[model samples]
Target chain A: MGGSTVEPVVRESVGSAPGNLAIASLARTLRCVECGHETRLEVHQSCPACLGPLAVTYDLSTLRGSVPSDRLSGRPRSIGRFAELLPPLSLPWSARLDLETTPLRPAPRLAEWLGVETVWLKDDTVLPTGSFKDRPASVAVAFAAAQGHRAVGCASTGNLAAATARAAVRASLPCFVFVPAGLPDSKLDPVRQFGGQIVEVEGPYDVANRVANLAAEAAGIGVVNITLRPYYTEGSKTLALETFEALGWNPPDAIALPLGSGALLAATERAISQLREIGWIPSGPGPALLGSQPDGCAPIADAFDAGSDEIVPVEHPRTIAESLAIGDPGSGYEALRAIRASRGAADSPTSEEVIAAIRALARTEGIWVEPAAGTVIATLRRLREAGTVRRQDRVVAFLTGAGWKISHAVALSRVGSAPIHLDPVHPDLSQLHVGPRPEALGGAE
Target chain B: MTTLVLASVLRQSAPSLHQKEYDGFRGSLLEFLNTVSAEGGPSFRGRIFDGDRLRRYLNVFVDGTDVRYLSGLATPITPTSRVDLIPAVAGG
Candidate 1:
């Protein structure tokens, strides 16, 4: 019994601050996680009690209207279809390039293999930046412009930098991106293409993030993750909206999403709940919001089983899926709450399994996904095997990004299309050898 | 009572102190300051402190928003107002 003793993990206060100040007329505010203090404006760091993370408070209680299916039919292929859900702003439609209504295709083949009758993929790869980060960055950058801020910044891996730069460019604002020096070239190229002032620190992604936050603060720039976070995350709710609408306004039985900052998980839950509140869809047993993280960075998953409401920070993130390589998710605790409230579970997959899932997606579904999406798909399969997801239920998997953005990870997965060795040149009709026969090419001329 | 000076933890410099008094808040960031000199202390609000300088990734919030967005170190606080600091802690 002495050998079976369990060690205690100290739960440190999870600290968070508003991404930015809330405009008073916006009717939204920042809420203190420790003391539940609601304020129209604030300019400080850390909470007094327990020193927990703070969250943006919105008046979703007064929400109204269902997005007429046709209402979104003609918007540009951007995250703008759900403009009503975003903060009020005025900009040319072209400048906005909203992508609120991305495609949600059925994954019945995947479902059959996983023993599930219904499944769908919320494909965000086609977004302008080739990842779901574009969704939030679009809104965040738009809000920045609405506030008359000219420069937009972020602490990013690859996807957020790309999205922020693209959105800032579309809005004709200067963009500043801070990313780690070791970030994969595949992710960094897009950010550079957008003509952003890239600040590549020599340290890890966390170190780069530190520099970005400080720069944003000192320069008073509108950092998307720093100040525009609340509004930025609001863009993610559209994923849930589009998911339910694609399913005829009915919630799915389960939703498996890749966990990075945990904002997506929280936003998805709120979207489903809002659908019920606004009468767009009748309230029913909502989807079980399962989150998938790479084994290398599964702190939230660790906390879930530990039965704690806090997170223990992990340094030196080691995952090929750099998009989800966040070591300390600011919203991890909140994501835990969001999942538990929805009666969902979270899990992590090994790097090998993630790679296998990526290959499977490419071969079976004709969709090439990065390691993060692979983690989600693999987790969905695991849940099916564990009976957490029923065979007769509908499962919706949120594939956050495209494979092209992080093709380096996929290439490193040791999975490739069948190779075709071509003749170096058509030298004298294959050097006076075969026409198309393998044997004729074997002649040792 | 132990006064914990809360300031941004910059990459290389020490956590700069801002004030000496509690400012009526539980964790007084002021007590962490080394001095109030222009060049001697850490740089914040156009001033320097030799104590714990604000970290680069860290953002000091009186209630949640960055002090830079308000009046920097000069942002007022009440006895009940909570101060928070945040760094871009990714998942793991």
Candidate 2:
């Protein structure tokens, strides 16, 4: 019930400025995802004609043979590195938040454990906001500022709130964030630190989102994920772009990612297709885009498994992975289409499996990630066991968030009890069994 | 008469439909929408539906269950049932 009391910003009817030559040449039109209606690029949520989500359509002919390897390498390591492919902005690369070029480290130990030829972990956990949402938030906040909006906001589960708050601070814009009541304090602390006006809705995330959308519409405030989504979602394409660049411009055979709202997977597929269309990548099949979700609230996976085009929303979502607990994913239909288009699969693992994966990834690859990332690791194991992913194929699993934030969830799963009370002055050595050192026990050393 | 709840965002466009009653209305969701459209007039109709189908971003629920998972446009509504119209919420 704790809501912001700030006066609503007056609605600014800023029509789409005639885009710069660079943007106008590449971005052709905004196409409706449901009804295929085309319109000019403007500040609006869904299609005016059909109320379906609007997606950007580009004139790829302008990019033909334009982006050479040197062009990409010469640019600064940021989301704007592939400026030719992304939505054009007047802001310079240096002014933008540095969120791209995350390290894609090869995990030989993980590969060996999984009996695979090669495995690479795209470490997005090291992002500025400690999650991949920073990429999208950067683009969205910049777009909002460029459109002459003085403030920006969003409805977030956790990561997006932090990402949006940080990006808003970078852009020097007032930020408001609406989050579900009772979100983990660890996730909420960063938003407060970033100077965002936090509004906690007394309901699930969906209800909060609805409240945000209404506020945005009535107040004319730019809600990044709602009003500026067409431009905001474009930022996620950088994930695929960065991955290809790190792999020497060669697409992986398969890539696994956690499925929340399904925007990241949809954007990754678009990135791959756009790269191929622009002749940046060779003409061939792109990576199989595998998606994973927690079994408790896996509407997309359930739809995929049922072989249905319709995504049935879960009335109530229950899972340890709060980040991936989106019962009704906004991009569910598009995500399913991308998965099928790439001949990919979707899996939903149980809470126990996810916990095991979180431990396994930390032990094997030295990467600590939140439970959402664990969904991908667990799904990859399932895919390998099902023979859908071959031993010879190169796989990349995206680790999306930092584990330190969700350390409590991990400890609860691992220890299954409260901490043992011990007196520091007179500690019992029997309870803490000391083991022989590895070097002393082994003969080879 | 069924009790209808419109999301706060949709109130401006269809204020007449907000917690308004439709006495003796009985049929599928489509039929109910048609009745509301007739009573509220053209602007309300256009905002809530595109022809016979609900707008893509708008979701309808009968007694807390999404109509899409039920019978879609044909999902029936009782006189005592409460209906909710909400926009598709974004997730990350």
RMSD of each: 13.7, 8.6
| Candidate 1, B15-82: lDDT as tens digits | 43322334444323443222223322323422232234543234455554446556656666655555
Backbone clash count, each prediction separately: 59, 0
The candidate 2 chain A region of ten consecutive residues with least summed lDDT is A1-10
Which runs in model 1 stand beyond 4 Å of their true positions? A1-34, A41-78, A93-97, A416-418, A424-445, B1-92
Error of 1 at A207 (Å): 2.0
Per-prediction DockQ comes to: 0.10, 0.38
Q: Which residue pairs clash in candidate 2?
A: none
Model 2's TM-score against the true structure: 0.84
What's chain A's TM-score in each predicted model?
0.83, 0.88
Candidate 1 residue-wise lDDT at A280? 67
Off by over 4 Å in 2: A1-25, A92-94, A415-445, B1-31, B39-56, B61-86
